[model samples]
Target chain A: MIMKKTLKFAFQKSLPVLFGYLFLGSAFGIMLQQEGYNFVWALFCSIFIYAGSGQFLLVSLLSGGATLYVTALMTLLINSRHIFYGLSFLDKFKKMRQMYPYMIFSLTDETYSVLCSCSAIGGIDENKALFFIALFDHLYWIAGSVLGSLMGQYLPFDFAGIEFSMTALFVVIFVEQWKSFKSHIPAVVGLVSATVFLLLLGANNFILPSLIVTVTVLMLCKNKVMEKVGGET
Target chain B: MAIDYKTAIAIIAVAAVCTFATRLFPFALFSKSETIPKSVQYLGKVLPPAVIATLVIYCLKDVNLSQFPSGIAELISIALVVGVHAWKKNTLLSIGLGTACYMILIRTVFA
Candidate 1:
């Protein structure tokens, strides 16, 4: 009974992700298909690597015949923000017991944001909810990509701007976080830092540098930021 | 494609390993400790808001403000997202409406 409720709750929370991942994952699948890879490759990549940006980059890298060393380096750089995600979840996921490794491996940007904002609900086992949320999201991704690969050629709808769903997801999350948190300073710092870097370095190269600066700035402002956490909601 | 099947598989495997390694780095370093250090704990607490903010920017990184549409479509759609979300506090409605609004703008108004 409780298990069913948990599944429903997790599914409710993952609804936004369902739309976002289905579109984005299928887009990846379509891209890979255009490069002559089949659904098998899409399934393989989505199931294994599971990083959206990394997988997209992989399609290009494969087409360009990038060396394994370059592939590794590019993947690391693209996914470097994931390192910070683990930091936030280390203690919470420790209670997940045997599921710890899988939780860590499946921590994509969307999953991380959902987990961050998620709170314990009445009558639901928090661990189970978290686990199911991750699992459902993974399933959605795999299904979307595989479907897209198989049907890429037949799709007639204009998906030219469907990718905006991803942006909407992030914006929704950002607004939620902004409203829930007592201190807006951290968010402001992040926005300022990222925008500055985006302008200075341009889009393709700004992520890593922006992340580095955000972390550094947060570390330096630790005392001030911590002070505002006293009455956090 | 420039790469053969075998080489492509190898590259995918390498990418997977590298991605997992990044996610595992913090746990490998700090999981064994009896208690997480104060500094690390503080970062863990505060990084989410900051990171999410950065991600919002990351999503829009490709929007070229100097171009024809001049990012007007993105600007209006995001404002709608923020506005509708703040008023309704409904995640699904906000995202669905925001995305639909964006698609319409790009396809017609900005096309």
Candidate 2:
């Protein structure tokens, strides 16, 4: 009974992801197919890689015939932001026991955002919900890629700007988080740091530096920030 | 396109391993201790909002403000999302409407 309830709640929480992943994943699939690979390659990459941006970059690397060393380096640089995500989930996931490793492995940007905002409701198992959320997202990605690779050229509709759903999802989460917290300092720090770096270094090279600056600023003012958050919660 | 099968597989494997390595790095460093450091705990608490904000900016990084559309489509759509979400507090409705607004803007007004 608890398992069923958990699955239902997880499904509800993952609805936004279902749309975002399906669209982005299918876009990845169509791109891969146009590069001469087929659905099998799409399935393999989605299952193994699972990083939305990283996988898109992978398709390009494959076509460009990038060396293994360059592929490794590029993947690390592109996905380096993930290092910060695990910091927030360390203790929460540690309690998940058997699900710990998988939880860590599946912590994509979307999953991280959802999990960060997902609060525990009464009578529901948190760990199971987390596990299912991860599983559902992974499945949606796989299904979308396979579907797109098989029918990409035949799709009648134009998905030109459907990718904005991802941006909108982020906006929704940001608003939710904003309302939940008493302090907006962290959000401001993140905004200022990212915008500065994005202008300084182009889009392709801003994430890492921005993250470093944000972390450093937060660490430096930890006492003040904690006072506000700690008093509220 | 000119790459061989063996090379392609190697590239995929390397990318997968490297991606996993980034996700695993934080855990490997901090999980060994029975008690996480106070500083690390502090970051764990405050980083989520900051990170989410950064991600929002990251998603919009490619929109060129100097161009013809000049990010008007993104600006208008995001304003609508924030306004409607603040008013309705409905997640699905906000995202659905926001995306639809962007799609229509790009295809019709900005096309």
Candidate 3:
């Protein structure tokens, strides 16, 4: 009974991720296959690398013959933002005990959102719900990737713009976060800094510099930004 | 287009390890401390929105405005996504419709 209840709640919580990951994961698989990697490679990357955007970026990096150090640096820069996610969940995760490492390992941006909004239901175990949500999401991603790789081997039509699903996913999340927040300074800072740096440094190299500038600016304005934004978040 | 199997595996391992380390860093550092520092708390609140906004920009980094077609398909599709989502507030519909629109535009018109 408890297992059934936890599974149901986890399904409900992870429904949003279901759509996003399947499509985006398939997109990654297709992209990888287009670069001549087989389905096994796609499965391995999704299962292990597991970072959505980083895995997408990884395809290009590998095909370009980037060294391991370079690949690691790029992955770090791309996923550095995850560090902030761990901070928010510090207290909640500490209670997880044995489940803590798995929770941290699977805390992608989408999972973080679902976990953040997870509330205790009358009959469901919160930790079990969190665990199941994480597990189901990871599986969906793997399923999508493997399916995409298999389809890529036989699809006759071009999927030229299919990757845009990723962009669309991020936009939806951005809008949702926008609605949730009272103050818009942090959002603006991120948008402007990234846009400016993208134009200055061009697409290939702007991310690191943009992240540095955004973090620096946010830190400098920490007092006022936090005061205005308050503790509502 | 193919990387050596050994090289490919090495790169994947590196990417996985690096990504995991970042996620694990905060818990490792602050899990024992009773109180997270004030600055860290403020950042925990504000960084998500900015990071997400930055991701949006990252996704669009390749849409060139100076070339022929000039990102028209991308612009129209993105606008459709934003419009449909703002109006209907449906995530799957917005993404599905927007992606289908882009696929058609690129294949039929831009082809």
Candidate 4:
């Protein structure tokens, strides 16, 4: 009965991620299928790599015949934000015993969002709830990828600009973060740096440079940025 | 278009390893220690807003402004997203409508 209740709670909390992942995960799978891989490959990538945006980029990287070293470096840079997520969870996760590994492995943006607010839910074992949330979210992603790849293989319709959903999702998050924060310096720095780098380096070679410059500039002005935001709040 | 089995496996393995490394870095470094450097904490707090903004621009990297349609499809769709989201503050609505708008524009109007 307790397990049933916990599972119910987990599903309710994961509803938002369920929608987002199914859409984005299937998009990744469809894009992979367009590049000539099958559902098996989609399943493998989703299960192993498990990062949605990184997996999307992986399709292009693989299609381009990028070297192993290049793939490693690019994936690391693209998913670098996960490192920060781990930092904030260190203490909470340590007490979760065996659940720590899976929790760490499944700390995607959506999962983190869900977990951050998880403390508010009363009358449940929080650690078990977290584990179930992580597990369900992972399964949802795998299911979406497999389904999308299968559909892409057999189904016939124009999906030409469907990829724009990824862009739209990012835009929504940017808007949300903009509204949440008092200081806009970091956002401005990111936007300006990326825009300038995109112009100078073109689409193919701008991410690394843009990221480097953004981080450098943010670090240099950390005190001022923090002071401004701190003053506001 | 299929990558060779060996190379494909290698790439997948490398990617999995790299991703796990990032997720595990802080835990491995600070597992026995309680202190997180001040600079690191500051970056943790501030980097997310900026990184997300960077990604938003990164997604638009391929848009061409000098062409005939220019970036009209992208611009129109994004404006709709922003407007809808600002009004409703609904995540799914903004993305679904913006994406649908983009798909329609590209297929019919832009084409």
Candidate 5:
């Protein structure tokens, strides 16, 4: 009975991840295939990079013959924010000694969201579940990459418009968070900060600056917001 | 027949090692302190909205906005998503439905 409930809860938690992995991963696969990297390359990149932005950026960088150091530097720049994310859960996860490495490796923006929100004691069992969820996503990306790479060689239809899925996913998350939260501080802070940084930094450099601004603003929003907001999550 | 086995193997092994090192470095390098520093916890609280916002704008950075219809469609979908999320407080339905609407607008009406 307890196992059944855990399964149900885990399913509910990971459903969004499932949707994201399949559609976005499939689309990314098509792109990789069109670029002439075979299925194995796709699988390897998806599993290792495991980051949507970094992987997408890596494809073009590799195609352009960028050096390994250059690619790694760019990847680090894009994903540095994850360092802050990893910090939050270290205390919660230190108990699972054997599982800690895989647990940390699988930490994506999506996985972090799910795991951070979970109220479970966050022991080895929860760590296992989170790892599996990430593994499931990793598999979807590999499968989609293979399908796209093989199919692209023969398929004629345009794969032009699929990148919108990422935006579509973002829109929904923004909306949901906005609606649920009582105070508009977080949403407003995000929108305003992004717009401002987009103006100041242009497209490429805006993220880090905007993140800094958002963090500065939110840190001052009162601690009770997180604790007493009931379902403001 | 077309597979470049050497390049493929190189990419896999190198990327795997590098990736593993990235994930493993923090756990191994850091002292075994269970109690997180206050600064990290503060970041944890501040980062959710900040990250969400970053992901959203990043995706739409190159959106073709010179044309009014696609532009309108984009804004409309964002608005619809916002509306549904605010009213129902449902993440899945809001995102799924909003994406469905976007796909339709782009493929059928805009096409």
Candidate 6:
């Protein structure tokens, strides 16, 4: 029963991201192959920096002769929001003894959705449940990356705009989240903060400021969220 | 054909260290039997949407708005994306359709 519930959650929750990862990961794989990297590099990237956007940025920085410190700092900046990803998962993964590390490592946005929605799944162990979802999504990316690298050996076609698949996927998630909620405070806060920050701080620094402002605003609105919590959870 | 072992090792080390550093935080910082601070939890609820907005605008950051046709192409594409998802409620369909439309719009209309 537990096994059945977790599988259903994994499939239902991660389907769109699986679609997104297949194309984007494959594209990244093919690029690495073309850059004279063997399958090992692609494999390692999937295993390690499983982040889609962060990995792409890292590749560019690496090839451009950016120093290690600079690459690390840029990666930290680009993925600083992940610190929040960690903070949120604190309670969720608290009891998973052996699988805790992997859970933390693979906790991307899509993975979080799959885990968060798993309360719908009856009989699943939180430990194994979230672990498998993370593992499955990571495998999707790995398989896609490997396929792209091997396909690169013979392909003469363009993979140009396919890179935008991540952006498109995010738009899809945005719409889904918008549809699911009556309160638009988070959505509005996100847009206004990101836009304002983009204008004030420049493109590179926008995410950090937007994140800080969004958190601040949400904290101020906590009383309202608590009311919702009292009503729902 | 030959590959440079030194370069491979360097890349591997860099990638490994970086990956480890990222995983170290949530695993280390938060697992001590307490809820995350209320403020952080609230922020997580709000942050993902904002990140999406940044990504959307970032795509347009390089465009020369003076090339009004290109700007029009981007705006239409963005609207088409939002509309497709709203109507069908399927992410794969929305993203795939949006990309196909944007590809054509950029190559032909903006060209």
Fnat per model, in the order shown: 0.85, 0.85, 0.73, 0.70, 0.34, 0.39
Q: Estimate the TM-score for candidate 3.
A: 0.83
Highest-DockQ candidate: 2
Per-residue alpha-carbon lDDT of model 3 for B36-95, expressed as tens digits?
888777777787788778877888888887887878888888888888888898777887
Give per-residue CA lDDT, model 1, range A1-233, as digits (tens): 89989999999988889978987899899999999899999999999999999999999999999988899889999998888888898888898998999999999999998899898889998998999999999999999999899988688886778778778888988999898887898899999999999999998899888888988988888878878886331
Cα deviation of A177, candidate 5, in Å:
3.8
lDDT sort, best first: 2, 1, 3, 4, 6, 5
Give per-model TM-scores.
Answer: 0.97, 0.98, 0.83, 0.78, 0.79, 0.81
User: Which prediction has the highest lDDT against the true structure?
Assistant: 2
Better of 3 and 5 by TM-score: 3
lDDT of 1 by residue, B1-111 (tens): 566899989999998899999999999999789888888888888889999999999998998878889788988999999999999999889988999999999889999
Write one digit per residue (lDDT tens) for candidate 3, span A1-233.
98899889899778767866876888889899898888899999999889988998899998898998899898998888687678777877778899999999998978876665456798888888898999999999999898888886575766568777767766777777787787788989999999999999998788778877988999988777867787743
- Please, what are the lDDT tens digits per residue for candidate 5 over residues A40-88? 7777777776777667776676556555576566766766656556655
DockQ of model 3 vs. true complex: 0.58
> Over 4 Å off in model 1, which ranges?
A231-233
lDDT of 2 by residue, A1-233 (tens): 88889999999989998988998899899999998889999999999889999999999999999998899999999999999999998899999999998888899999999899899887789999999999899999999898889999798998889889889989999998899986799999999999999999999999999999999999888878988889422
Report the C-alpha displacement of residue A102, candidate 1, in angstroms: 0.6
Candidate 6, position B51, lDDT: 51
Q: Candidate order by TM-score, highest to lowest? A: 2, 1, 3, 6, 5, 4
lDDT of 1 at A23: 76
Better of 2 and 6 by lDDT: 2
Pairs in clash, predicted candidate 5:
none
In order, what DockQ does each candidate have? 0.76, 0.81, 0.58, 0.56, 0.40, 0.41
What DockQ does candidate 4 score? 0.56
In terms of lDDT, model 3 sits at 0.83
